[model samples]
Target: MSQRQVVQVFEQYQKSRTQFVQTVAELATRPMNIEILQNAGVMSLLRPLLLDIVPTIQQTAALALGRLANYNDDLAEAVVKGDILPQLVYSLAEQNRFYKKAAAFVLRAVAKHSPELAQSVVDCGALDALVICLEEFDPGVKEAAAWALGYIARHNAELAQAVVDAGAVPLLVLCIQEPELSLKRIAASALSDICKHSPELAQTVVDAGAIAHLAQMILNPDAKLKRQVFSALSQIAKHSVDLAEMVVEAEIFPAVLTCLKDTDEYVQKNVATLIREIAKHTPELSQLIVNAGGVAAVVDYIGNTKGNVRLPGIMMLGYVAAHSENLAMAVVISKGVVQLAITLSEEPEDHIQAAAAWALGQIGRHTPEHAKAVAVANVLPRLLEAYLRAGATEDLQTKSKKALKNILQKCVHLPALEPLLHDAPPNILKHVVGQFSKVLPHDSKARKLFVTSGGLKKIQEIKAEPGSALIEYINTINNCYPEEIVRYYSPGYSDSLLDRVEQYIPA
Candidate 1:
């Protein structure tokens, strides 16, 4: 039928009979017929049908509006502009389950267009109505209401806060605990959206008992659900230190560490990311990760996986190393320093290289022994090279320079001394020489080897002028081991002594 024919049929049926409105309602449900109905300016006509005494016309008209709004944003905005939201909100409380479900479907489509339209729906008090629907007997109505709320809450912080303020969090948590896996997934996802907006909002979800539910769900062997659960936990953990501690208090490390070895790459990456977030700046949490074998798991992934899967693991190792001296030493004990250095030196991707450099820098910030471990891995030359390479981003350069400075200032092992003397920038070399004077004891083998390895000659060349720190350090080393230095450079220097010194040097 043409637009005029549809309009004429509606006009003839106006206030005349229920059968006429029902006929038009049935026609509105068809996709091909919506254009004709719209051309007839039927949105105004459909408004009264939303309140029709007959349940069939009410259900069909709401379903038709939903279908029509699904076609494009203009129709959805038209539905909102016609004041359909309050009517839909009212229909959600109807005794008839069909009317409630159909109204929720329409509202979901209408509010899915944009943040402005979503706020329009929320402003009409649709959030309270949707929260009420969660307690309904019909699962379909509950699921649809949860979906609509999820769509709105996912758009922006204000709408999400609106949803939470309407007391939707506990109800959504209830939905997640239900036996139906599909509804549980939707509810979990909605809670994730709600918590992702901010720490205050995320704490609200945690206070409502989401962490326990999500932690339990993460343990399931199903890879798909585990992915969703890990992602939700990660979002929650990202916004606050308290939430991260809650994740640890829930004892989620074992399950999370298991996910690091998951066959699915996305699952592995997200789980690694969650671990990284939890380990940030919390020494106790970092130790928990280390105790649970998380450090080894990440190191193995960086060694065994390629492309995107390895990047998050590298980053996790970095976060774990940054927390404390003991944790940094743990990373060195696990050979993480060697793995990170390899990535910095050999990985083609600049992001991975930058991340590796960052992890090394963290490791280098601890005691002199920790710095010596990194230096023995032969990472300083690669860091210097990465710092000098053309086209490196400011972030890459900053990380490289920071790592180089940390190693030079802390490491006093003799084998790590030559590279600083020969390869480090002038400013860094000055710091290295000063650090050596402080860290090396007067009678130490490392001090003896420093003079034997041409360290004094290199320092004299790099010193700016007489009585500088470099020059002063040279005087201290010479005063401490004058005889050994002269014997080492003399014609009859023992090969065994030189061989012992060479053993400490990296190949």
Candidate 2:
């Protein structure tokens, strides 16, 4: 039928008119027919049906409007501009469960369009209605409501807080424990969105007992739900030490570590991220992760050909190393040091290079033994190369420089100091001098090595200036040198004249 005939029939008010509108609404849902209805201005015809006396017609019209707005931003904005948000919010309060469910579906579609449209949904008091729908007996309505809340909260913190203020936390927690797998997944997703806003809000979700539920869900072996569950746990763990400790205490690491081997790249990536967040600033926790086989898992991911998997994995290794000497040693034991060195040397991605450099620095900072291990991994050259390479951002240069300094400070190999002295830039020369001052202390063997390595000559060249920091460094080294002494030795009774000889040795 033509658009005019359809409207005319609805205007005439026959017994079957509701069915006609419902059929038209159904047709509008199909991609092939949606454009025809939209071009026909069918939204204008269906707007009144949203308030139709018959609940089924209202339900069908809302569904059609929702589907039209599903993938089309323009139509969604149109729906919002038409002031349909308030009507949808009203429908959520309807006694008819089907109408409420359809209304929620429409609201979710509209809110998902953009942040601005989502704000409109919130402004129209959709949050209150959605929270009420969460308590609905109909599983479909509850699922749609949870989804709508998740979609709205995903865009902005304010809206997320609004959802939480409307008491969505406990409801979401309950939904997660529901028998229906789909509801559980959606609720987990919603909880993830809500917690992502801030630490306080994340703690709220944890307080609502989301951690236990999410932990259980993560073990389901359902890749899709597991992804969402890990995402939620990761967000929660990010905000506070207590939350992270809680997550660890819940014994979530085993499952989280297992996910690193998941075939799905996304799952693997997110799990790596979770491990990184949890391991940060917690030395014991870092070691726990190491003991749980996370060290090898992270190393394996860093070696993956896929950048997505490798980047986060590399970053996680850095976090683990940053916490403690033992964990740093764990990284080296896993042979992660070599992988990071290779990444620093050969990875085209500057971010990966920077992260690897940072990880190496963290490892080298612990002790001379750890620093030598990083040096032995051959990262020193790559670090210097990374610093000298053109077009490297200042941040990358700083990371490379710091990593090189860490290795050099603890690395007693005097040969490594020679090239740096001759070729380093002025600033780097100063740093090298400063590092050498610490390494070359008041000892005869060290002084001899410093002299043989042309360290004295390098200092003399820089000390030529009237005022130089090198003067202090030179004085420091000179003060450590053995004083010259004249020794009179009587070789035999026949030697009348004492042979005077001067020899420099440790006093």
How many pairs in model 2 have backbone atoms within 3 A of each other, for residues 3 or more apart or on separate chains, i.e. clashes? Answer: 0
Instruction: Show where candidate 1 strays beyond 4 Å.
Output: 1-115, 238-242, 306-312, 346-349, 435-507
Pairs with backbone N, CA or C atoms under 3 Å apart (clashes), candidate 1: none
- Could you tell me how far off, in angstroms, the CA of residue 282 lies in candidate 2 after the best superposition? 2.1
lDDT of 2 by residue, 1-507 (tens): 999999987777844757767687678657898778878887787788898887777878888888888858888888988888888887788648888888898889988978998888899999999999899887888999999999999997888888999999999999988888788889999999988879988988988998988887666867878878888988998887888899888888666777787887778877887888788847877888888898998888777745546777787788888887888889999999988877777777787788889888988888877887887776676788789889998878999998887776676555556667776766667666766676678456776777776776566556324457755665665566553311111123234342322343446
Local accuracy of candidate 1 as per-residue lDDT tens digits, 1-507: 999999989866654545655666677567788778788887887788888777877887787788778666888899989988888897787648898888888888888889988888888989999999999877888888898999899888899999999999999999888877777777887888888889988999999999999888876776766776788798898887778988888888776777777888878888888888888747887888899998988888788777667787787778888888889888998999988988887788877788889999999878888888998898888888888888988888888888888877787666766776787776677777777667555547776566667775565455466778767865665566566664555443578677788887776
Spell out the clash pairs found in candidate 2: none
Q: What is the C-alpha local distance difference test score of each model?
A: 0.81, 0.80
Per-residue error (Å), model 2, residue 162: 1.2
Off by over 4 Å in 2: 1-45, 52-57, 68-74, 95-98, 415-423, 433-467, 470-507
What value of lDDT does candidate 2 attain over all alpha carbons? 0.80
In candidate 2, position 19 carries an lDDT of 71
Q: Candidate 1 has what TM-score?
A: 0.74
Candidate 2 at 221: error in angstroms? 1.7
